[model samples]
Target: MSRLAVSVCLAALVLAAGPAFAQTATPQTPNIGGFPDSPAIPAPTNATYPGVIRYEVDATDLDRHIVSVRQVIPVTGSRITLLYPKYIYGNHADTGPIQLIAGLTVMANGQSVDWRRDAVDPYAFHIDIPAGATELEVSFQWLTQSDNSNWRVVMTQRMLNLQWEKALLYPAGYVSTGITFAPSIRLPEGWQYGVSLETTSFENGLATFAPTDLYTLADSPMFAGLHYRRVEIDPEGDDVYINMVADEAANLAATDEQIGYYENLITQADRLFGSRHFDRYDFLLGLTNQMGGIGLEHHRSSENTHAPTFFTSWAASAGSRALLPHEYVHSWNGKFMRPADELTPNYNVPTENSLLWVYEGQTEYWGDVLSARTGLHTKAQALVLLADRAAFYQNQPGRRWRNLQDVNNHNLLGYRVPGQWTSWMRGTGDYYDEAALIWLDVDTLIREQSGDRRSLDDFARTFFSPEGTDGDWSPRGYTFDDVVAALNTVEPYDWSTFLRTRLDADGPDATAPLDGIERGGYRLTYVEEPNADEKAVSRNWGSDFRWSLGFSLAGPNNRIAAIQWDGPIYRAGIGAGWDLIAVGDRVASAEVLREAVTAAKGGSDPIRLILRNGQRIRTVELAYHDGLRYLRLERIEGTRDRIGDILTARRR
Candidate 1:
């Protein structure tokens, strides 16, 4: 037989035997159990460390963004484990960057010793001490972020924000409060700095601080710049200083009226809490566009950064004034009276966030209220901002699936990751704004139930500042039950059920809690013109047509920034990131788009849009007929204005 005929015969035989092959037994799969984990590093205990840690950081290498460290740690045992910080306090996750440490060397008696990283925990390093070796010298370089690829660059040509936890490691056996550090830093020439730490001495460019516990050292970050100014906002009381740094000298210019606002902020906070937590406080304000932005909270200080022209352009920057108030409120809410789970022994332990809705949410509510009370934002602006928030939660689609309680875990799942479908996914920080709305509900309910004689302010004073601890800043832990007890003490009601109904409700039937708006004597209504706060925000964030066309435009080139889920444009198969090419017959501009939407209202015509999605070009006809809808708060007749009274400044 020929070779071709032989091949055809083989194929025919295989096809004829296919059924028999299919009837063969299935192959058995291998199964294996996981290998046992290495023994855990020593758990932290309350015993005090025998000796202090001598730590030094040389951040003078600004051009390369390298932070060099040399730490001398005293040792008593033969085997010791060192742990890199994993759970940053404000971040609410195990997000410390262990990958940034390079050129690590451990030395004993001037001889390099071998070290091994724990297989299960990469943040831990194990080393054996040689006989008669009293201390171990460790050196490493922290490669600070130099570009904008992932994180914000902390080091710039003219300024730097030094977070101490990023530079040093701690022994594993003792709690963070038991380990002490005499920390020092060397900065660039002619640069002044601001920190919450008490400076013991300064020589040349190096500054040395008093010996402090590991927990406090990490919390006291430094903001240094060539142009710096310090002003005492509360000189009559526990010294509260606004330590400001800027890239340019002119950016530090604060008019007398602008300075008055900050002074009013201190007074307003004092009256609201009716107690002091810290002996001294510092507002570390960075007025620079170059440094990595931060708004983190600490017990006695806060890290805040704004536009370089924050003082120079006060009126134009009104929308951003609430940042200081928000972070400052954390002193009473989060830093002092903290959640029990968040009061971890050390930085490596993970934290639970069941009460973040109260920690971050109520602070957000009080932040805006304090902003209004201190004249950071006008009373009219405050109402408009409230209206905007009301409309947002009312239109949000994520509530159909995720409730407020479950959303607290989002910090660990995906913190700060942007989403194309953000409205449905509900990003991590929604607790800030959404919880604010819930607290508003609580505030209004309290006032109504008490016949206007009591409010959330009473709850804050009684709960945050208990009896006989007037000037204490010690950490006081609380549980969910404690929160309920405090609320009931302020106003007698089923506080637990009230909070759970709003926190645990989900599915297709769930809706926003807007009873607060109604009870506060305002009703959320749509208008043809944008409110003042919205217009000011739109100047930089682009136009918002969320209610009219169910989409908004932002960023460069008028691209679709956000599209409402299952709304007009979404139902029409148009999505975000589509660049607007034209609106009807005119070039695509905010004005042109508004005109097109208005023209289509009450008419048979569809809103025509020419959009370029990637390389594909297509024309979409939106069936939306609503014309330029914007949200505003209207006063309800014959009802008390509870919201106004809530925001009104309290007399000392």
Candidate 2:
């Protein structure tokens, strides 16, 4: 084998037999490959690497829902420390996906070999090689989904979204970027593939990608299916492509107007971040409810998995359209100009998410803005999304105990928290929503300080737009000081203190956030009837985000997931996980609860609630008389509505 891909282990199915060939040799104390303490396996050098970790991914087992990966590694050592990827780049809940890797085995000289796992690192393996072996190969089956878990590689009869790290192993010593890789895939016959990768060849059912470093290779994922279509969204040689793979060809058929909106999306994004970091960009979309459902950002592309009707049922998926723009914006913000610590050399390094408030938060801010600016979302639709997100943070009781910084760092445990009493006890993704509010304040402040001469657009162009695009996918890191410096360059002020005060707060002070909303030319108020965005979100969760009543329910059953701290429900001694037994004479479904709230809208009538907390049942009278108080971003009379201007502003 060449000495590039895997510094692999080799064995001849030969054994140094002693009394070890006994029956007990395998069962209880199975043979594990290792090397002598002296003259340890020679450290693989940078110069000797063959420049590509070649992978031949076979998806023929799609019907069986398994993907077989065969890897060839160039090695010189008698042993290689190989590990499945761990600690996903931006996920705090990293372990949830790593376990999906199954049936991993290493081989040498076409013979099965024994490999030992490092006791300390669950993902690391120490493989043994027979003397004189120059290369190693491994074949493994990665199960698409676990028995009953949603966390798995998405592989269906129609398409597949390959998260490379989960399916391949790499040598441990070198930085992932320093090592090179060339990947090729053999799809089930007639299936076409779309990826941001530079393709070297494409022939019947097989595609080869240009050689890339380990980091870039892993970052470049592919979406392939029997039914696929690529729509050019930009006229500049179609630098932007909407690569869609759906369960059926009908889903691939999108209206011209719908497709036109994406073209504007590309235009607005180009206007926001002055320079393009990628040579080519793809919005790799999977319109399949069969599997994958989140948008992950990459340098040249975004993995956008949404409901099957992402195009056809656009209105119903109102708020979700933001996912695409959000991940796309990350190519400039989170992927290009990242926080220094987050720009790790390899995939295994734990991410320091303390700045996610900026990484994800700012992206969330622009995601909403750009989505609206591109006409994917109406201004009202954007406001609904912002208000919903804002109300979530304002009502989050955990924010009182944990500041935004701590909330940002909560991903250290991979976002795994007990469900009981989660509302007040735990913080979920506040950085995305809450940070959006904070950054909105920053944008408004920029306009205010600059006498409306500049806005956050100036900030983005200043920080992200380089003189030229390096055409490299690897991230260029930044620091907190770098962020403050950039803001200062736009308009001089105590940005350090300004951002620190907002992010470091540990109290439920609505003054700053409310003021920020007002600055956006709207006041945060409530109205009757949940908007389409709210109702759409409610229908999915089976409950309403009744910021007025202060609780989110588990749905048609009206069981509470959480109650806002210091809110009326909390004051009434209500807690999470309790069943809303009844509202006066009616059994408490979300409808009854809303009706009860509506009935008490005009007067100081007390709504009597019968709640069941485990074995105890109690009656509580909540004197909340604000009519169906759904949060809204209503116009502040005669105030400046710069939101529209902010959405369209660009450097001329």
Candidate 3:
């Protein structure tokens, strides 16, 4: 079966059979202004001359998540035009076919002019006006969801006004090449400001920044609200801006520490690249009251979200800081150079780009390594974390079903489902996990292959060198073939098979590129041991409880749904969805009995579940593993000179 089909089926089954689970509930139909249909809009034929641009946005309806915008573009030559991005970045989807542009009135020289929606791509909207018109104004209203606060404009209502996060307004002529932004924000009192851009505050709550190039403009994100702290670093060249916007008051000390961490990360990246790609970079922290965290990279800035501080302790905070290194490195991998396929079609339509294992996976590996090497994390701690990633891939069941390349290419559709499944299995044999291991393996291999002469640093320098052809990776992006060819220049070995097995095939024998490590006279084995910190954290939670309510649910058929953590069935070693036969001492109705489990709690209740494994019905007792569930890492010194040696030798 195709991997996509299998993943969908498995997800459905798990969702139906598993215990109660937590997930981001899809919001009700947002007040997304009005639904805009692309097909209904006519396409543009002729090119119109560009014009001077000025924009004004009034976003008072924070509760509705809507805004009114007025834009004025000056016609220079033949045509005057305006366009709305058909697709919002980071969303990886169309803006819900929603039209924020309601009552889009267009006027030229103070007279209403006939205009039509010319061309529409998920990336942008095109509008045409009379040629050589001195100026034009376009006004519209945009509607969105308040909870949606990653990329694009978002607002939160508190007290009497709406707060803004990730808002940017640009003149229509500029190219969106992920640049630093300079915008003018006008708001009423009781509002604060945060941006990655250089800004000057004026009277009447107006903020302005000098116009920067298109690339620089894309790199800056703006946040306005009452909940933020500005930390200035080194006033030598403009002020290094660190804007932290959280839902609650932040601990100044912690915020300072985070700012320092970012400073160090930027320095290390700059040192490695040997060039400051951007005049200024902004790091905007959007603290949310959510469970998940994400970091999105732009040319000069990154937008990040963090969990609630109360839920995250110092150790957790330190660990979360690892995201800085990861996103900062993107200033190279993703910002300066990116895969063409991803940059072109983007997520509007599915394009086959399988090199995310290199872009994202390798970046992930290096992000952590650099963090440790630069003292952001202890070497031992980093090593343990790497080992944990290895374990996760090795334990995941989905790894048996899909290869890294397949996962990368289909990440938009299958990432979460298979990802969760892989996590559940505690497997570290997948792409991110395996790529990390292989990087360590290859780093070791480079050293051994060159008799301690060369390292991954050498390879990276060559691969990412400014003069290198691969360095021109943007718009269309590079491919595995491109990366392989680059690596081959450093090491003469044929790496085609290595890429195919780990990245392409999902079979059981898909081992990591460990042969090189092994060839470097090193042996590697993964072992699990008790982690004191994890145990301590879990101990405070309470007794580990696992419970299972019997069900023979299929995703489309009678499959599993969700498995609650620390539930009775989970303790009995029952997974989310296995075909259930008998419950306790009788044939229990899956639906009716599940309701009973929810209604009842701990009372030394023993519920026997008979489930079908493959074809045979097997009975297992569910017992929760008390304490916080954490994966532990134990590595034995192999014959190899660390993992890096093995990879080095293989390259040679």
Which candidate ranks first by TM-score, i.e. highest?
1
Candidate 3, residue 616: lDDT: 65
Q: For residues 333-388, what per-residue lDDT tens digits would candidate 1 score against the true structure?
A: 99999888899999988888888888899999999999999999888888877887
Please give the CA lDDT of all the candidate structures: 0.86, 0.75, 0.50
Superposed on all Cα atoms, model 1 deviates from the true structure by an RMSD in Å of: 7.7
Rate residue 95 of model 3 by lDDT: 37
Model 2 superposed RMSD (Cα): 7.5
Residues 213-252, candidate 2: write the lDDT tens digits: 8778777788889889998998556689989999888888
Q: List the residue pairs that clash in candidate 2.
A: 2-74, 4-50, 6-73, 10-129, 10-130, 53-181, 92-414, 93-414, 542-555
lDDT preference between candidates 1 and 2, better one:
1
Question: Could you give me the TM-score of model 1 versus the true structure?
Answer: 0.93
Q: Assess every candidate by TM-score.
A: 0.93, 0.87, 0.67
Candidate order, TM-score descending: 1, 2, 3
Ranking by lDDT: 1, 2, 3
Tens digits of per-residue lDDT for model 3, 131-176: 6677667666656454434323456652112112122233244344
